[model samples]
Target: MTPEFAYFLKVNVAFVLLYAFYRLFFYRDTFFKLRRTTLLAFFGVALLYPLMNIQDWIREQEPMVEVIQMYSAILPETTITPDNVPETDWHGLLLSGVSYLYWGGVLALLLRFLVQLSSILLLARKSKVMQIYDTRVHVLDRPAGPFSFFRLIFLHPGSHSDKEIDEILTHEGTHVSQWHSIDVIICELICIVCWVNPFVWLLKREVRHNLEYLADDTVLESGYDSRSYQYHLLGLSHTNKSATSLSNSFNMLHLKNRISMMNKKRSHGIGRAKYLIFIPIVGGLLIFSNIDAVARITDELVESSFAEALMPEAIQLPIQLFPAVNKEEPAEMHRGYVLSKEELAAIKRAEEQVFTVVEKMPEYPGGQKALLKYLASSVKYPESAMRNGVEGRVSCSFIVRKNGSITDAEVIRGVDPALNAEALRIINAMPEWSPGEQRGKAVNVKYTVPVSFRLANKHKASVSGTPAKGIDTSGRIFTVVERMPEFPGGQYSLLRYLSQKIKYPVIAQENGIQGRVSCSFVIGADGALSDVKVIRGVDPSLDAEAVRVIKSMPKWKPGVQNNMAVAVKYTVPVTFRLQ
Candidate 1:
């Protein structure tokens, strides 16, 4: 899952757990102020926790790998036919639809929130403004009860007695002083955006409920008679249909519970200890949220090590075994020798064991070059290994059976544990090879292959230019690194440079071909840019211009992985528009 979706899931899950715990343990308790603080704190932490990268902390404790590597782009093969055409990917479309729906919901809720604010503003303007004690109040012409929005309290003064109005003012004043309307507005907006989650609505209700309890407790503490204030609350709560949803209205909800809570005795200070549970709760969410990040880091480290081993200097394969076995029939037949029945039976028994040497050795469908191509294409450089700078040789042994099927693959010599696993995975995924032959008959053969993990080197030139010696331009380009390669100044400077330097192609401008051309390239460890290719093209002229401008860019600050500069792949969009 993407980090954004994971963040949403984590926040919702945290809210569910917190709200459930509050209802089960503390909702009925008379710790109103503490309860209010806890509710807000719960959501506040939830909002910020997902943004923290705890994976790095975990990575520091991990043992460091001893090797690092760099990589280059593998040139595309030009043997495409109609049968090799790609199929449409429905999973990408599904994900896009989900993203669109989520943003649509958010926008719709934001629009509703704006509409509610406008309505509240309109009501405030129509009502007459007056000073009641130290607070400025809006006396509504309609029958909406004693509600407070921010600092302004709205009430129908003519409908209540002077004493009742005094009590009502006290209630609304507590809301304004405590900024309970801020909590209401916050909850309203969160509930609107997260309308799909039931727990969010419950948490919203709990926030408002706790605020009311707090206000009621404050009035009782200030010497108001509980019985009289409760009576006033019941009388004023005539279900004002015109009451603003976004305001903290006096009789908003849970009248029975508020009255009961008013009569309950205050709990001991030890009740506050329950709030400490949030520490572990938050810790758990942080760990859970970073699980995918940890996996990604581990993968990078493995891939980095493997990429380094891909360099020619690191390849230590046993060349003696790799010499092509004589595939053609031997030039001369050897003299035949007679054997006893017992000797033939012993030879047959030993035939099950794999032979290291045969007249004709097993071969891949095409040749050794084709085998290397398959390995290069099939191997997925692990991101974790790249980040950790883990590089080494992973020697794997497999059996090429009489039926030309690969089997019994095992790692004989290992380097980094992650790289070893990845090497084994690639070997196991290989297609069938030609069977080895002995005495003109197919036989099982054991083969050992060593995959080197070495970091790629710095190149001194661009793709359409000559490179310095000793750089093998094989291996796929990497898209991520510890620190991404950047232009000398920064992103804004790079954008400015592109704006000034890039000119619209005349053919594109005349044909009205105005679209973004996405160009991908690899920045070598030496910071020289290479492999500039247009990944998504608008027109031939535009594509060529984008590639040309990319080629003209100066050396970038090379990308780093495992404290070593490595070849990193980057993509940029160059747009051509008609003026």
Candidate 2:
């Protein structure tokens, strides 16, 4: 996944879990003030938790350890076979649709928020203002609000009796003093971003309700009759069904829950201990957020594994920290794994040596995406190879010097001579890179890339001036078919054909180079063999002979897919046995 998508998922998951914990522990408690603080803290933690890198802090390391970089993925031995419709295209299309839908919802909701906010601002200008002490009250001519927004409260003073006005002002004053509008706005903004997540809506509701609890609790504390205030709120609920979206609405639609909390006995201080749950939850999130740390290991282990993959005894860059011969000082000196002082001195080269890996890998003019785009837009298919329908990936390796100059460009693995030279040309022509760093010092680094050449759906019209007939040019080569293509005369006759047509090279025979050659090819819908290339070669002559024989075969029955002829891929092994 891309970093942006992964971050979106992490943040939403955290929000859902935190909201769940709130409902489970503190939802029913009468600790109105503490509940308000806890909900706000939940929002803070949810937004910031995913960004903390815990591994950087808690990772234990050996003292004086050498931090060599080992990248096994640098030179992969895989072919890149581009299809007519790459799977990535479908994935990108799906992702685009989802992105459009998400942003559309956000924009629509944002427009709604702006409209609601504008309506309030417009009323603040038109309504008659009444300054009661430190508060500014906007008296609307219509039956609207009885809601508090920061220091501004909106309500129609003419709609209520003198006594009711006093109770409404007292309730709204608590909302203003406690800055409850800030909580409402916070929840609304979070809900807008994470509207797809159902749990956030519940969390939003909880936040708004808690603010009401605070306002109601304050009115009861300020010498108001509890029974009369409760009746007044219920009456307001029936008359006013709607209010401002971004403000603290005083509608009593949630009167049942609010009244229950008001009548319930006050929660004891012991209830605060439930908040200890934050420790483990936050700790769990930290463990999850730094999940990439689990893949990290000391380079020493990776180097050992890499050596074993090649000839283990043939090459070894041994590094170990051995203490001086002081008392109680042990050193890391394993048998056969340690190097002598003289051998170490001899192996240690100059600082100018090119590194296979470094503290930071060199970056292309742009990042990986731009690098791919540059290669795609700049690369040209060799006309000779294209005419012959030759296609495969060319794996190349090059060094970026300390001064960011490209050098030592060579194709390590090649499909065809023409394609190999073309791949090298592109690498040599690349612009300078950002030099890699090792120990805060600029250093040369080696980079590798596999450039794929494919003729999956290419028409011969561009190359040979004739359209490719009997060709699909619409889909990928089928690996599985209802009817598999076979050699014209079965396996026995096919072996006889190769034995009679093949000529073992005198030089290879003299050199005793005899082994199996693994080759791949595609049998087109017209039963013509194409896209022939060697997967593994025993010798250059043997590889050529194998491909030549395969390409010269007579037409076989083409593979059938969905009752239609389709191109089928096949892999065959040709062994040269010296008898």
Q: Write the per-residue lDDT of candidate 2 for residues 196-258, one digit (tens) a residue.
A: 988888888898889989988988898889998888888887676435767777764678999
TM for candidate 2 is 0.52
What 10-residue stretch in candidate 2 is worst by lDDT? Answer: 309-318
The estimated TM-scores of all candidates read 0.50, 0.52
Clashes of each: 30, 0
Q: State in Å the error of residue 295, model 2.
A: 4.2
Poorest stretch of ten by lDDT in candidate 1: 330-339
Give candidate 1 misplaced runs (Cα > 4 Å).
60-97, 296-579
Off by over 4 Å in 2: 61-88, 131-135, 292-579
lDDT of 1 by residue, 348-390 (tens): 2244766754557688889665776566556654656655555
